[model samples]
Target: MSAHRMSDPLDRRRFLTAAALRGATVVGTGVIGATALGAVDADAVFAAPLRRPLDPAVPAGAFVEGRITSIDGGVLEVAGSHGDYARVRVTGATSVWKVRPTTAASIETGDGLYARGVPMPDGTVAADAVWVNIVNLHTTIRGIEKTRLHLAHGSHEIVGNLLPATSSASYSGAAPTADLSGLRIGQGAQVLGAWRPSDDSVDIVRVAVGPGAGHRR
Candidate 1:
């Protein structure tokens, strides 16, 4: 985000509001996890499959994806699947998201990491953003039974398990709510949560339904 973008809060609010409205009718990928602040970013994350492509002005080496094998001080040793490796350094300014906005202390070894940052002189990635164990996807509500939501992701139907203790829903860019009465069958939604590799299911943390999804009083 540039300074001009942050100069006015309304800019983001308005943009997100429009984004929410646009997302309401569209199903997209989810990046799981709920934020007390809300779902505007959740809606914007995948506003469109390729709405705003990555900015080329940013340096090329600003991304690092791998598994955390070790944490020494503020740095994490990452091993990529393709025989690649990297050293990621987390700083105070770094925004860490592990189920929620957290700190480096919450990060653990063996957790997956996808970082966006600058390259340091020491060949380390000076991370500005870090997400641990996060999965973002677009899904449509197929069915809902109790705490479970059957979602259709592309051609596959996967169950979205809502964790009552931590799961939340964001409506029309509003703050997160424990009440999930907003979710309706056949509605498109964005989900941010953890992916259960064991069963190919998802443990939903935060769900974002666009403006047309309706508002609950």
Candidate 2:
């Protein structure tokens, strides 16, 4: 028989089982954030610099805000602080963000807003955002719903809300409708766009998921 003979099946099985157990243990011990897709360290995933405070000197093209009464047909129903309400369409470029529970509680119907973005013909505001939350913690996600994805990263988790893959949202290839059936759950993602300051949620602009990622428990 050759020196390089086939390995023992029982040994290999044992080794693999041991490795899997170790991995699970590490994840359970809070070294990694677990999701339906995969695990990432909390320090690495939720780690983002705080958004700068709003400046009065800046122009109106910098930000916008409104209450989210409806999210139907890829459109957002927002009533402005100045008593103006409009339905904004989310095209192939909108990005969605989800925030924490404490952050979501501060906001109520009919609040003042200041946003920055290119204006649409119908008086709807579009652009990225910067604002203050009820708490001092740095935020990443904006508005999370049932199908929204969350990956545990240590004690914390990486969260992502669904949105229309629009030009403004930074998606180019295919558009995932607001319902987000096509997008895989529990994947590594980067959410970009306007955030609701008072509520601590985001109106997403772009979402980037990792390669070959899947969901986990």
Candidate 3:
């Protein structure tokens, strides 16, 4: 059966609209805060930090992470990381963010995605928000300087730059602190940052350093 036909038209629209609005509000607040913190370039702060992974035991609606295989109309066919398949339906109200808040048109096939939305009975996820190509990396700090950290994520060496006013660090989930002086060379850290569109570098948003730090999303 078609996923779109499973719900009452009005009710489905209302649900999706509410979900999208909520997602937009969340992203909008982050962007405003980043801007206030000297992130003058919209693209630099578009991908806000995702502090932790969603709990698998929680009953929160659907959260899908994967690479997009195809786009047909407003629907995206995704090949999930865990070998599952998902059909994500995007709508006019869907909040899509790449490096910054953008329209759904900015999404492309082969892009990696993380989507939050309501799962429909017919197995399609009605997406409220989608983040494209955002990367959360756990690595060891090989070296550090006043403005950059040289990191080793597996075999890849990543250069992460600290945004002066927006970059922050947290210890063991405590409140984030602007002072990054506590970071040490060879420490394990997790970086919540945006991957450069065509490069291996990242623009650091928040760094979490402590025990068990090399956790993947």
* Top lDDT model: 3
Q: Please say which candidate is ahead in TM-score: 2 or 3.
A: 3
Off by over 4 Å in 1: 1-61, 81-83, 171-176, 196-201, 210-217
Model 1 lDDT per residue over 103-158, tens place: 57777788888886666556877665677878888888899988789998899898
State how far residue 204 of model 1 sits from its true place (Å): 2.3
- Please identify model 2 stretches exceeding 4 Å from their true place: 1-62, 100-116, 127-217
lDDT of 2 by residue, 1-217 (tens): 1121233222211222233323222211222233323433333333322233233332233245656565443334676667777644332212222332112123333433333333444455432221222112222333336545443334665443344443122223344334443344454445544444444444444554434435332
Candidate 1 vs candidate 2, TM-score winner: 1
lDDT of 3 by residue, 1-217 (tens): 2343343233333445444334333222233222112323334323322222233332236789998999876678999999999988775445577655666777788888999776655577767567887888999899999999999999989999888887899976777999999888888899987676456588787889875546543
- Residue 83 displacement in candidate 2 (angstroms): 2.2
State every prediction's TM-score relative to the real structure. 0.58, 0.26, 0.56
Please give the lDDT score at residue 215 for candidate 2.
Answer: 32
